[model samples]
Target: MTPVNPESSTLYVQSLATGVQVLRAFNTQRASMSLPEIASAVGISKSAAQRFAFTLEALGMLKKDSQSKRYSLSSANLESGYQYLQCHPLLERANPYLLDLNQRTGETVNLAEPADDCMVYIGRFSSLARLIAHVPIGQRIPMFCASTGRAYLSSLSDDAAREILERSDRVRYTPQTVTDVDALLTLVQQAREEGFACCHDQFYRGDLALAVPIWDAAGNAVAGLNLSVSSTSFTVKRAINKFVPLMLETARLISTTPPNPTALRPFRTEPRGPKEAG
Candidate 1:
């Protein structure tokens, strides 16, 4: 009798997984990829990459350039994310409050949920004053340095937060990023004590962000709400003093809304392994 390979279980569709991996290989760093590049990025053979690329192109999920022979994500790739945001219960409840904060402060307001060691931006309202070039919905920022990340971390038990911090890559994104685990733990502890987190030019230079965690009805932290203002506009002390109370109020108001049991339960305080690409 032949032994069954557990990794090739009948319930798991390896081909579908590989096809998704091929699409994920194209990201902000590599917006367009050749067949060889796709194969190398996805750890698949060139022929398999070609087959998956062809299938994805046929499905309207990828577009192939005739001249360059490189594949890029199509408009169809956005449909899933759009559908998710449109239907997400948390975003539905939080939007009004987030918009209010944005209008009041005239700063960029964002809502992020934890994905392993990174915070994924799910909601954003641009500041009328000036828009930051990089932040878009679906962007991921490191949990070790971002204000939203720290706000979420502050909701977790110290041990769990430490585990996450220790597992993070801990590279300095900017000179201001606190990469030491002990120092980061101190910051999380301070955030826990203060009921909010603040970052000054940590993730991006001249970007100052302040954040507070959003909790579910069950007292689990499900997400974070943050407001970002440029250093050119306000000093850190002034920004904190001006925005912290208002942000706390906004986050508190949003937290009161009962979250979808199934949609939100996964984001509670437990540490996660590295997130998988969709």
Candidate 2:
């Protein structure tokens, strides 16, 4: 969990934070939950959960099932997300390039930005061809296992990367996931050497991803650009040989100018669940 800076603690509103947490309790895995479940998930009392749920429902951010009393995120929640995408300067600049790459590769293209120890998918362009799965915007993948995560880490100092790796839970999601901090650091080093990162079936079965970090004019790593392909469609060598150049070129084009430092931010109030991390 990311806490506000101690210096700004006086400015933080606990109620507002808790309200956002209540909304975040719903996800692809847990699409709908009961009041008791919400209370348990948010670490609040049942009455508190009920009040928040009631308020959210009234505000149209959440909807309650009349029969089951289960609450789920409403369409109104998309307003904030849509507004963010529309207003983000970096996203605005990257969309054309991302679309070009999507058309060129006919594969999944994503732009992910770091949020604490995770990388959140802020931009996603789906493949025209057959897809194994669909990952929506706002998806958070652990920095320890995701190719995008590793790519972003490669751009950071070794000590900075190690600190985040240590803070991670490091749960092995698949046979290919490198949970050991030393092993993971080695992968980051390899990315630094190769100028990109690759992962094969680390977070999802039959999913292979290659990523490169996006940098600003000042040389700060601001985001990661990645393309995901099905294992059935291409081997690691084929993917690297074919897509790496395209990925690098696209990233370079998008990084021509720096964007607002605060343009990209995470929307979640908590860390993503195991299945959600890739």
Best by lDDT: 2
lDDT of each: 0.83, 0.84
Candidate 1 local lDDT, 151-258, one digit each (tens): 899888899999999999987887667888888888887678667777877888888788888988887889999899888887666776788878877877898654
In order of appearance, the predictions have TM-scores of 0.87, 0.85
Model 1 sits at a Cα RMSD from the real structure of 7.8
lDDT tens digits by residue: candidate 2, 1-278: 44557436776788999999999889878899999999999999999999999999999999999999899999998998899989998898999999999999999999999999999999989997867667779888998888899989988788999999999988888876778888788878767867778887888889989898888888788899989999888877678778887887788789965422322222122322333233
Candidate 1 least-lDDT 10 residues: 269-278
Residue pairs in clash, model 2: none
Highest TM-score scorer: 1
